[model samples]
Target: MTEYGPRPVDRRLPTEEARDLMTLVRELADREIRPTAAEEEDAGHFPRATFTLLSESGLLSLPYDEEFGGGGQPYEVYLQVLEELAAARLTIGLGVSVHTLACHALAGFGSKEQRTERLPDMLGGGLLGAYCLSEPSSGSDAASLTTRATRDGDTWTLEGTKAWTTHGGVADFYTVLARTGGSGAHGITAFLVPGDAEGLSAAAPERKMGMKGSPTAQLHFDAVRVPDSRRIGEEGQGFAIALSALDSGRLGIAACAVGVAQAALDEALAYTAERQQFGRPIADFQGLRFMLADMATQIEAGRALYLTAARLRDAGLPFSKEAAMAKLFCTDTAMRVTTDAVQLLGGYGYTLDFPAERYMREAKVLQIVEGTNQIQRMVIARHLAGPEKR
Candidate 1:
């Protein structure tokens, strides 16, 4: 295994505190994450201890309000931290994004009492979270989900299955959306369910091409009861809350995509400079040099696009269009850049002996998750031209 790790990113952080935070993140990634990533991923071992450490260090709560035990960092700063973590390991980076997404509904829309009692422990108390929305029959058409949450006085009985859940069986809590009224989007409602709630169960983790250490499983809710206090918003507001969370979550995915692309480019750069070909380094060849240059340029463009969206979010602007654009372009860039990286490493890239193959496999999922790139195009077009006709 050739020495391969993330290169130092030249970020334009807003404050000295943020810069110091980045330094700490890099040190932690280099020492704790990068060293064992390949081996652990190969063995399908989840790093629960690393996530616990992150919770203790305040990284898990960076984008929430400090009043609730969060770090109170701007979206810009929080996303850059995500990028750094993703550069080290996709499982860790994507897991953090999912956990943050799970917290969005309660943090943004829960009653004052709910926040006062639950937010503190959730944000920094070593609790992991998962978001439950997509179901066995519904993926892109989320409005058609069949999960039911029927109210019985002060309690609600939830019964449904959630597919492709990131944390699945291992999380401490779940932010779940279920149908509480008639059909379609307006019928949905959000609830915060404890992982150990009676009748809650998870299927085995899916066999995946990459990020094997991150569990992706289906969850079954068989008459799981949740108190009305756990309801995130009004009975019919779940879809809106879900969409709001996704707008920000898409930015997190964009940043992670850029991180993966950056890592791939760094690996290509390292290999090309050292591997001799025709009595000189292959990097000396014009063909490979141009490929490397293109990879770097794409990584920079993706980073800029995601950051621009993050800044818009930080500034309290309507950033849905920008978020969709960033998710679409950055993920596509990751797929392209990682493929080119494999080509640059030639046969060596395809083997498990190097990390380039893993990068390429991991990049494919970013395009599919958090609204497929095709769905993102529809979102951007809707913003530009208004909703489409039936």
Candidate 2:
């Protein structure tokens, strides 16, 4: 079979600087990420050093404000960078996305003092972060989360468990949500908690089928205390902050999905061109050719959809619906395309000897993370037809 390598995506970056950024990202992915991706992933090793390299290279803070140590790139450029990194290794790409999400509340809503004091380190000072919103009992109905934060003078003590945190044990900081007053979304508040706080601890990482290199775990806050200065936005505004961050985060997931789909398509194309059957390459057959064409088309469409949403976000227009649409379509496309890639590879695709099976396994989680595909549909419908009546 022909040797498989990442095909350089023809990106339509707006500025020369953005183009240069893409080049740097591609070089880094080739040099520091792609080479050991399979091995590290197979060994379930989190590439902390690789993340440090990304931080030093300024890839970790692409979409935030420059004054706060961000790269000041538009979401369009930032997301394309994510796609490239994800094509090389999903763990790195998704980790960056989660870190960005973790910084959202503070970056977007914190006071100037808070941003000046904390944003620089969180953004580019080599600090990894995690978002804490989901709990064991509340996943889809996040408004019903039971985590509580009680205020005593200038200190807030948090108590509860947050489930499915992406960088649970390894993060340097966490953006946490907790109920401050009564039950439901309006009573919730957001806080920025240091990872090494006395009462903060992580449970064992969840054993997952794929993306094993990235830890997903539950965090228990046992009277974890935070100064009032660490509170992000006003009390009872946490749910809104969380939802706002997720709207952008869904776009990140969409980009990662396209990356996975593109990688799978590339693999299938390489394998089909060299694998011969009945005295001709499988790629020469019309059926397989059609399959390849469909895969490529879906990937292109998904890319375009995400870019459209990103452009909308950059222009400061409403993009919640578009973000939902992109997340839904792109992740579903990844699932379908990766499955077809496995089919094209035949028996080899089913084994760990080839990356196709790994791609297939990895694609399955995209449909479930950030928000489930079912939730994406609900979000889309809420925009089109209004919220469902209770």
Candidate 3:
């Protein structure tokens, strides 16, 4: 219905079901998300209603088990769905990714009883979730987190501050990591904490440049007590669990980046073709044409990279290195393409009158989140060079 874009992407989905899912997502995006994205974002309003609709429509729980209210879709199909959602609005797409990340620890490592008891509500019960791992002093060096969980008889007392939490105050539950032993990665443990727990409070959301609708804030746990049943994985295994979740989460970020890049390129193509200049459209100029061609090519390449990583993940093979590469390349591509898009649109692009500037700003944070592009390089380097010599 929104006739202000280049053309729809021709996706090669694996199954008819996947194709239908794509169509449903596109329809929903066109009708609900794409229309209000700019207005709601400008107002700094979080679309909790839309999020509830997504939950009811089964869009929020695609990559998990069907028996537990998930869609049981493969990563290959799931990431593409994420891409489509992101092309409409990055806030929703990235929020879904973060929600998936918050669910990973329990889905992958929780005991059978825990899964049966809690996974259903989490997957499709309309409960939003947040992942808490990064702290004020520890981001790239996540193992150095100072948030600690002290043990008592049957409960663990959580006392620490978690920074940069994506859903911070709004989330219904939190997947938190804290130091439970000595210093370093081996001393950490994971816990599932309710958002309403007494003494657990969220700071005012950070004033971010873009993605204003998604709250990113620090969470404070002042002697919040969690039962032993909420512990995820072994006591000393939290770091490894966090890293494993990130490997998959990076793919989610990569898909979202590609979606944003594609959206920018579509806007650029549309603007160039219609807006006239001296004699004809500016798209007639060779210089600008080449830029559009390069942007499109980069988007395709980034999509292919993430899909390849998704396939590797679906096969249950080792894909951490490829995931890092895809995240790195796709996010960097988004940043470059979105910036170039703003340039191609000339003066109007810089103004909020067009979505170009918003796309550009949103693309910037993609490179910084999930893992900074610099940290991604370190990961790739370690995979190639086989860990640094101590």
Candidate 4:
């Protein structure tokens, strides 16, 4: 019989340079992230040095402008690289995604002067960023958020709590969506809040199920003062900015899901082929072989879906619906794939000895965060029902 090899598809996708970078990134993740991820997660600590290396490699700014030290790659490519990174260390993958979301407002809508001023440092090595939009009472329904930002002539004094802030305490800066007028999406405004601002404090990190190295905390904006110049755009644009950022954020989460699924699949395949049962390896069994096939299929499908949406975004088309679809499908696949990976390995998979357990734990969060899968369905359904065919 003819020898079999990896399946052939449109493998020739990303540019040569991007492929080279991906190889380097995968090697870096294998060397640096995979080894330390578990320890950091167990200790509930962030990986500062890893992020510095990511920034230095020009990975963090892959989708940003080249003039500001960014690689300026397509979101399609940028997201896949993120998936590769996440497959090694989810916390780092998410940290990069959230930071990218935190910078979305300035990149997409800010003035040229603003872009030129902040892009370099923000894209520079070792810098971190956060996006603050959620509140204790408002999550999926963000318009009803209670954070108040009162105008004081040319300054704004913000007072309220922003919940579920990623990179909460450690971020160099934050993109804050706060109330500037009345309650509702229209009444809000966005600001770039520096970490050193007076009256701004982050609560102790919240205990999480997975991706523990990615810090999550509440931010208390108690009369935090900011110059009007720091505003991301016009007044009443916070909702718009937040929505735009989230549209991008959804893709980030989708990439993360793909990564989780890929990692789980990799472990399951390795374990199945190496671990012996009865007279031979588990890979010899047809039942388990089908499971491995399913895992690989799911990961491939998820990758294709997210990359399609990312391409739409890079092409400047309306991609909100696609983004939501990708987020919903990929995250759900992650949950299912990782769960199957655990099942394939039986007792051994249930323990911390295998990464399957951690991958399973990490998969759950992707379904809930970045506009829950429920919300994603609503978004998709709305677009489907709309008059325009997009």
Clash tally, candidates in order: 0, 0, 0, 0
- Compose the digit string of candidate 4's lDDT tens values, residues 1-390: 001112332263468777787778777887888876777787877898888998888878888888876788899888978887788878988888998998889888888898898878888756889999998889999999989989989999999999999899899999999999977789999999999899999999888988888889999998999999899899999898899889999999999998888888878888888889998999999999998888888888888889899989988999999999999999999999999999988998899878889999999999988999999998999898865466
- Candidate 2 achieves a global lDDT of 0.92
Which residues of candidate 2, in runs, are more than 4 Å off? 1-11
Model 4: residues with Cα > 4 Å off, grouped in runs = 1-12, 387-390
Those runs of model 1 whose alpha carbons end farther than 4 Å from true positions after fitting are 1-11
TM-score, candidate 2, is: 0.98
Report lDDT per candidate.
Answer: 0.94, 0.92, 0.92, 0.87
Task: Please provide, for model 3 over 131-210, each residue's C-alpha lDDT reduced to its tens digit, 9 standing for 90 to 100.
Answer: 99999999989999999999998899999999999989999999999999999999999999999999999999999999
- Per-residue lDDT value at 211 in model 1: 92
Please list all clashing residue pairs in model 1, or write none if there are none: none
TM-score of each: 0.98, 0.98, 0.98, 0.95
Q: Residue 183 error for model 3, in Å?
A: 0.9
Q: What is the lDDT of residue 164 in candidate 1?
A: 97
TM-score of model 1 vs. true structure: 0.98
For residue 112, give model 1's deviation from the true position in Å. Answer: 1.3
